[model samples]
Every structure is written in structure tokens, then in C-alpha cells.
Target: MKKIFGIVVVSLFFLSSQVNAQHKIRIACIGNSITYGATLPNPEKDSYPGQLQNMLGDGYEVMNFGVSGKTVIRNGDNSYVSTKKYEEALQSNPDIVTIKLGTNDSRLPYRLKLDSNFIDDYKALIHSFQQLPSKPKVILLLPVSSFLKDSERQTDEVIVNQVIPKIRQVAYEEKLEMIDLHSITADKESLFPDKLHPSVLGETILAKRIYESVVSKKKMDFDIFSKIKEEKKNSSFYGYDCVDFIFKGRNCKVVKPRFSASGLPWVWRARFFGIEPQADIALLDRGFHLVYCDVAELFGNQEAIDCWNAFYEKMHGAGLSKKVCLEGFSRGGIYVYRWAVTNPKKVACIYADAPVLDLKSWPGGKGKSKGSQEVWEIFKKDFGLSSEEAAMDFKGNPIDLVPQIVKAGFPMLHVVGDADDVVPVDENTKIFEERVKALGGNIMVIHKQDVKHHPHSLKNPQPIVDFILHSVKF
Candidate 1:
């Protein structure tokens, strides 16, 4: 009886193992020659699918169903749907399907049919995968760049201008994730000796990119850091590399760390950048990217908010953290507070140094401090306030948004000098602190003894650093 019971237990253990093996996440890679690793030294081992399988470990089964010279359009010269590999892929019962079939379609014969048939055929193919018994999550991949000069064949011009746009349209219509392989590989022409197929190194890059997209819960399309070398003017910020670029005619700067922290966290400095370098430098040492966009004269108006909104979209698309730390100094405080109030959820935390909570308090000089009349006129124009009465009645200050700010639930930190005459602490930070505390909001204040607006930030910066790191949960 004991021998029989032991045999039953062993048999059950084997059955469980078999079930686990059968349940591995099956991935079907559908593409053309690029996906098949045509130019790689060893296609079987160095192909993107093989490398992806290794990266995914024992929990995933990645199968390469790529057939060379295949087009996504059904009426094209060589349609992927007509291939036996397509039939095999349909039978694989995959949980995930990655479709990357537009390289050969850029050829003249196939390119002609793309205008009418590309979107329809692509949707049909995606639908076929979606209807399978396993109901796989389908991901579309924009074809990699082809440096070949042959106009009649796969050319970078057609791929970028025509093919990639269609893929993006299809992905948008289908509501599926799309990875931008073309942009990722466009500058890596050296990896493609033949100008068409990626070598082993290129395949490795493709594999890693696909792996990142597959594993990430967020919808990451491309790595923005990859384009910094090609698109921006490089310089140095403190000790780190800084890249300057223009977006929508606005000057922008990004200071990158030697290594990025997890989730690619960043600090968005509103104005007066580099005024107080302590916290920025400390955060950089801890792997935080510092970024700035020039909305200086706009003064947190609708135009400034619109510019920030567009800039935020670009930054988020480039794979920065969804939430960002906002840093503001003096008049720059207006920009940060206005933007944060408008987009509360997008903020991780806020750090204001001798910040201007109320424009009326500083620029209007309606309170204890003597405000700037010249800047006040400009501020009024920017905000569309025609008279002093309009400026006085304006209820758009940060102090007015305490309830909304508190409800957004992001923490705040303020550094101020008791002797500040330019932007008095009593009329700004103190009032803001009282209102925020009354509303049960989280905020911290650091008072500088005998310090004025001449200098900003903390001497040690450890306290400010701790506040930021803790808020971002780094």
C-alpha cells in the first residue's frame, strides 16, 4: 500500500510539471527578413526572437514565424498571409503576437498597393490573431530603417514618410501598442553592413528594445535618450552631460545622469535654472534628469500653460516618469504653481525656493514689499489684465488653489528667508503654509536666518534632497 501511494504522489508531481510547461506564455513573432535575422552570422542563436526567449527565461516560449520577402498587404507581390509560416503561427496558440512586416512592402511593386490595401489588410491580419482561441495581445512594430539607396527597393525615405505613418495609423485605430523601430535604428546604419539587414549587434539592439516594451507596464514607444546624440547640441551641466534642443521654437535643455534611476525619474525646473545648483546637483548624483523649457516672459498664462502641456507630452512620450518633480525659484514660482494647479496628477512633488505665491504680492507691490512696476505691467499684459483693479480682483494665485492642490495629494516643500524684501515671506510662503495646513495638505518649510532673495536653496541640501527622494520614493 505504501509503495502504491508513493507512485501516485510522483505521478501527480509529473502531471503538475507538464501542466506548467504547457502554460508557458507563448509568443509568435511575425515579420519579414529583418525579424528572421537574415544578415546575422547565426540566425538561430542571434535572431531577435532567440535573444528575447533567453531574456524572458523559462516562463515564455518565443517562436520565430518570420518569412523573408513577405508583405502585409494581401494583394502585394508576396503576402505574409499566404505563407505556411503564417499557418503555423496561427496553430501555435500564442498568448502574444508581435507583427513587424513592412520592410519588403517598401519595395516599388508592393509600395503601390499600400495606399489602398495597407490599413485594411493590416487590420484583417490583426483581427485574425485576435480571433484565435488563445486571444493573444497583438503588438505592431514599425519597420526598421533601410539605408539602401535603391529607390525601387526598401528605402529609408519611403519607410519613414509612407510606411511608418501607415503603421502608426493602424496601431492607433486598432488600439494596440506600437514600437517605433524605424526611429530607434535610423542612426545605427553601421550595424547594417548591407544597408538592409541588421547584423548580430543590430539584432541585439532590436531584441533588447522589444524586451523592454514587452515587460514594461507602461506604453513606451521609443527611447528618447537614443536621439540625443544625433539631434541635440551637447554640453556640460555641473558635472553631467547636457543636451540643448529646440521644440516648437522654444529652447529646451536636459541634463542627464551617468545612469538613470528606475522608472526614469526627472525634475522639471520652471525658470531661473542654475540659480540654486545644490538640490539639482544632489538629485543628479542620485540619477535624476534635470530639464528646463523657456516659458520665461509668458508668466504662467494660458499660452505658457499650453506650451508646458505640449512639452509635457513630448517628455512623457520620450519615456520619462509620468510624474515629475517641479522646482521653482522666485518669479519662477508663478510658472510652477500655475502648471501644477492645472496638472496636479502629473506632478510627483514640488520644491519652491523663495517662491512668489501671489503675483499681486511681488509684482503688484500691493503688500509690504515694493514690487517692480515694469515687470508688473508686463505680467498684467501676459495675463490679459487691463487695469490695476483687474489685477487686484484676480483669484488665480497659488494660495487660492490650496484645496485642489491638497486633493491632488502631492507633497510640497518651501525654502524661504525671513528677511526677504523682494518677495516677502509673510505674504507668500506663510499664507500658503497656513492655507495648505488648514486643508490637511502635506508641506514643509525651511527658514533661512538673515537670508534674503540674493541666494537660494539650502547650504547642506541634505534636507531638500531627502524630501525629494522620499516624495518620489527613490
Candidate 2:
């Protein structure tokens, strides 16, 4: 009887351990009442985490470890660190962890007084997760917007002006993955009927967005410099790998660097290959990748933009930066500008060298300088425009689209030759600069005296590098 009892005890213990390891991935969601699915109908069944678990399918286990009105800051009214849920989360031994505990922290008196304490305490919370045995992949979430009448107690302004910046700082400082939940909820005011918490439909949106961000990223071991020697030997491109892949039935190329920066920042080079490529080489040396999508003859039509858009999405999924620094030389300016205008949010900044801003000015030869007759015909064909229509439609040019560019609001830098005949500066950069500034847009133009369109980039390439580094924070 004693032997039988001992065997049964051992069997039960083994079964318990086996059950714990059954799920391939375990997720622990740590947050305040918002994360607890506050105000949602049947929160346990329809909360963001619950919905996420359903989306992630049966291979994962998601546990919500949220406490009502808990602040990420330890000294707040009800600190999350002091909660039983925090202890429970620590014991959960999760593979992935999401921290979304700043909504209540946006409430006073913590709201007014958080300062650096929020960052320090948030870092500590992240450290706690990092030290866990599972070594979870930690993602921090910014708080959803607030809309209270007595805004001082729970103000969206304070959250945006104070809390959100600090959370971004933390993400940068820690090099961790971050989700801007505030932006997700900004326009969806109806989702928060009570002014703070999200409804069921809102929760569904939040879950889907988070799911996309997580799953879209490949999550492979990113080797900064993996196969340089082999690529160089095969493609004859020195110090870079010219990767050929098909996008929308068109053969495309992604010029990859052996080693790349932390956030995977890259410059999408537009038009021309060998004109003062010093800046690109310098950026590559500093761990930035350079890419080129061959749509040279297409100009900047809708089809070309669509093709580049596909490339952007693919590279972003392949772990390149979500935002790209667009570098356009000569006629390439139209490509970068048009693409940036169409997908404003995806651009870091624009760097143009002797750019052909106006199609009528460059290809049509209707301005102070003579244009390319062969290229002009191709442009007409691509745009489906007759000569009369092309001459009249300055509206499609970058110069005429200052309002849209200003609306997009990405920084612009142009290097121009004051004495150039081909792609004349006065007809392109001069007008663009004047109009952009008048419209309260950000543009910096560098003029080269007695220089023409022959020399493209700066000899040093330092200024261009500095501008891009500043814009992307690489």
C-alpha cells in the first residue's frame, strides 16, 4: 500500500510539470485596469489579452496580470509593483511580457510630479521581467488617450505632453520594442465612451494592432553581416550584397550591408549609381544599410509608387527600419518625393542632390535649361499624358505639391548647383525653397557656387550623414 501511494504521488507531480510546459509560448500581460479590460463586456472573455490569445491560436498561453488603478511608478497612489498581480506575474514564468501600466500614472498627483521617477521605475519593472528565468521578450505600451471633463485628475494632455515622451525615452534608452497605444486610440473617441477605458470593439482593435506588430516582425536572429564575401563574389558589388528578389512581377534589388545598425536604419537610394556615392559608403561603414529599387525609367507614377510600397513592406517585415531615409539624385528626386508624399508616415527624411523637382522643367525642357527628350517621352507614356496636358500639369511636380509635403511634414534637404544648366536650380530648388518656407515647412538647401549637375554629393558626406543620424537617431 505504501509503495502504491509513493508511485501515485510521483506520477501526479510529473503530470503537473508536463501540463505547465504544454503550451509552446507563455505571455504575461502586466498593466492597470485598462489592461484588465476595464468597461469591456465580459472582460475575461473579450479583453485585449483574451482576444490576442484567440488570435495567436492554441499554441500560446496568455495571462492577464492587471490590477485596477495601478501606476507604473512605485510612489503613485496604487503602485503596480506593490500589487499581488505583480507577484503572480513574476511567478508565471512567461516567454513574452507586455507592460501597459501608465494610464493611472497619468492621474494626479503622480501626473504632475512623475518627472524622471516614471522612467526609473519603468526601467526597474522591465529589469524585473528581464531577470526572470524565461528571459521574456519585453514590450512596453504607451497609455491610451483620456477625455475626462475634470482633466486635471485624468488628463490626455498631461499623458501626451508628459508620460508619452518618457515612455519613448525609455524604449530608446533600453532598446526595447514599444507600441504607441495612444495613437491607436487617438481618433477613436467613441471607443472610450466613459472617457478613459476602451469598449469591446476598441479592445478588439488594440489586440489586432499589437498582434500585427508582433507577428509581422520575422523574429529571426539578425546577423548584421552574414554573407558579404559570398555576395560580393557572386554579384561583383564590392563591400555590399546586391540581393535580387521579385516584387509584383518586377525584378527588384536590395543593397545590403554586412553589418547594420541596431534599429536597422537604411537609405533607399533613388536613381543613378556611381555619382559621389561617398555618403552611402560612409553610412554603410557606420552600420547603415543602403537599398535601391530599380524603377529608373518609370519616373514617379502610381505604378512605380505601388511597387516601392511593396518593397517597403517586405523590407520592414525582414527587419529593416520601419522608416527609411530617402536619398534621391537628379531625376530620382521625383521618385522619393512622390513616394514620401503618398506614404508620409513611413519616411524618415528626404536628401536630394541636384534633384529634378519639376517634370516640365527637366524632361519637357520648358524652363531655363534644356531637358531630356528621350526621358520626356518615357515620362509622358508612363503618366498617360499628352504634351499639352504634361505642360499644363505642374500640379504633379514636387514644387506644386508644397501643401501636401507640408502636410506630410518629413524633413527635406536639397543640394543644388546655382549655375547648373541641366536641371536648373532656379527652376527647381529656388522655387521649392521659397514656397516650402512660406508654407511653414522644413527645408534646407545647400548651394554650390559655379558648380553644375556633374558633381552630385558632397566630397566629405559628413553633413548628409549628420542630418540623417539626427533625423533617425541612429
Candidate 3:
């Protein structure tokens, strides 16, 4: 019996050693509400520990070191909650330790003013992880928005003014990886539950921010499906929501944003970055925004035309004189060509990729079936004209608009794929580009191989942005 017991103990020890050898990587996540997911029940991974562990892959075992109601400064009353948990987790000799805290330390409730001493304490906390036995890569987790200071009920002004710049500065100086969770969580009310704590999506975004930042720093291809662009290095491509700072040129005008009966659809604008937002100030000052419109609202024909009309009216009122460069997908192409024929002087360029330009060209179009009869109804109501007259008025036919485009000498750039069965390239972009060139206009067409009508920003995300950036003329 004694001999059998000894053999069993040896077997158990060997098995444990084998398991440890199989999983060599260790990661730890430490922080307060956002990290522990306060409003949320703790899952095996509700914290960033689970998020990062899953991101690293099957080999990693990340420990959750986050604690709710924690602050960086303990105030000698022993109120600081995170330190104890962090110390315990470090015993495993982690390969990476992430510290996500300090917003609570900076906010008014705890009233913990962050002076030099506080910064020193943060430095020490960072140093402790740096000096760990494994000496893991340390990343500083920046905080997003604090609770809105009431009265605004909107967090746009709050985050843009107070939090983001400081966080950016910290990352720049410390040479630590900055996970810009604030970028996605800007409209805190949207991402948050009570407008104080984050929702499930927000927590997921927080995890995503850390995961991408760490992975991208290694300069490896980000394996995540949705690869959102993040601000990198000292090169400042701003996420500042101070929209007033964006000047619309001509008479040195600044658009003092006023909400119409429509409370300025700030949520939608923030959510959909249709294309890249980076722009040179000099180009904007010379009149670049006039040609672009957010076609997110358009799918139906009449609705699309109305949206274009509204955009044009606004540009005219703004005294925008510089020629505009136009780019959009599907129904947006319909609106752009329709307006360009009439207002030729205003159009600098146009590029419609996988465009829904002609009604008859589409499947189940109003020409064949009553598929778009609802759209036809709205068209009659809006322009008080018959179907044929309104289609001619809007010139839904880009081919018809060609004579006017030729006379105007507008430059255009297009990207489309032959594999796009929805909007066949030959019928749309191929024919249109040929017409523009025939009309003595310089048009650049990039035929994407085996792809569909995707935003140039969506595919390898830089060239189309560069084209737009350079396409503008003063």
C-alpha cells in the first residue's frame, strides 16, 4: 500500500509539470470599475484579463487582478483597492502586466487631486511591474470619459475638452502603448448604461482597444475582423470633437454648430466614419468639404435626391466657391451626378464606385417591377413631377449627365471590382470613366481585382484616403 501511494504522488507531480510546460505565457490585468466591469457581473473573463487572454490565443493563461472601487492614491487610510490584488497576481511572474486606472483618482467624487506625488505613485506602480521576475511588457491603460457633469446630457464637450489630450500626453512621454479606448467611447451616453458606467459593448470596446494596441505595437497583422484605425505616435491625426475647430474656408468662416429641429445627429456622425477623416488644414481652408456628403441616410431614390439638395443648399449658403471632389457608394453616386450637371462649376471631381446610377440598371428596378414603387411615390411628392421628368431632372442617368460633365472639365477617380455582381463594374464605373475621358476630363479608375464596392478606407485603408487628401483644389 505504501509503495502504491508513493508511485501515485510521483505521477500527479509529473502531470502538473507537463501542463505548466504547455502553457508558458502569463498575462495580468489590473484596474477598477471599467476593468472589473462593475455594472456587469464578473465572468471568467468580463475583465480585460479574459479579453487579452483570448486575444493572445490558446497558450496564454491571464489572471484577472482588477478590483472595483479602486484608486491609485490610497491616502494613508488604506482605501486604495487595486494594490493588494496586483501584488498577489504578480507572484505568477507574468509576461505582461496591464494597469488600467486613475480616472476615479482624478474625478470629483473621490476628489483625489493628482499632483506630483500622485504621478510619482503611478510611476512606482508602473515600475513595480517593470521590475517583476519575468519583466513583462508594461502597458498603461488610459481612461475614457468620466460621468457627464450634468446639464449637457451630452458628453461630446466633456471628453473632447478634458480627458483625451491628457491621456495622449501620458502615452507620448512614458513611451507606453496607449490603448485609445476613449476614441470609441467618446459619446459616453451611447456606450454607457446610466451615462456613468459602461455597457457590454463599451467593455468589449475597452478590451478591443488594449488588444489591438498591444498587437499592433509588435507590427504584426491584426488578426481581429474589425480593424478600426487608432492614432499612433506624435503624429496627431485628431479625434477631437470640437467641430468648431474645423473651419470651412472662404471669408475665414467657422461653422458655429446649431442643432435644427434635429438635435445635430452627433451620434450617427461619430459612429460612421464613412472614409478617413484626416485632412490638411490648408486644403480645408481652400474649400475641400463642399463636394462630400454623408450618404449613410440614402437607399431609396427620392430620399437620396432630397439629401443631396439639402447638402447643396448648405454649401451655397456657406459661400463655398472652391471646386469640390465627390466620392461615395451606391445611391450616393446617383445624387452626386444629378447635382453636378446643373452645378458644374462647383464640382472639382467625382468618383462613384459600384454606383447605383441608373434605375433601369438595377435588379427589381421601378423600370421593370414595382420593386422601387415606394421610392417612385416619394419622388412625385418631393418634386411635384412625373417619374420620367424627375428622373431627367435628377439625371439618374450618369450617361446623360456626360455632356454637361464634358463641358465642365471635372476630374474623377473611381475604384470598383468586376466580381461585384450587385453593381456590375462594366455597366457603371467602366462606362462612366470612358465617357468622362471622352469628354476631355482626366479620370483615374482603379480596377480592384476580385473585390466588391467597398469604401477605399475599408480595403487596405490608406490609398483612397490619400487620393481624397490630394484631390482637393484651391
Best by lDDT: 1
lDDT of 2 by residue, 142-238 (tens): 7877877686677888887788778767766676666656655766788888988889888887788678555642323565234222232224233
2 or 3, greater by lDDT: 2
Model 3 lDDT vs. the true structure? 0.53
- The true-versus-predicted C-alpha distance at residue 340 of model 2, in Å, is 12
Evaluate residue 128 in candidate 3 and report its C-alpha lDDT on the 0 to 100 scale. Answer: 75
The Cα error of candidate 1 at residue 463, in Å, is: 29
Every model: Cα RMSD to truth: 15.3, 15.4, 16.4
Which 10-residue window in model 1 sums to the lowest lDDT? 216-225
lDDT of 3 at 464: 48
- lDDT against the true structure, each candidate: 0.85, 0.79, 0.53
In model 3, the Cα lDDT at residue 298 comes to: 41
Q: What are the per-residue Cα lDDT tens digits for candidate 3 across 422-460?
A: 566766777777787877877777777778545432322
Clash counts per candidate, in order, are 0, 1, 0
Better of 2 and 3 by TM-score: 2
Candidate closer to the true structure by TM-score (higher is better), 1 or 3: 1
Ten contiguous residues with the weakest lDDT in model 3: 258-267
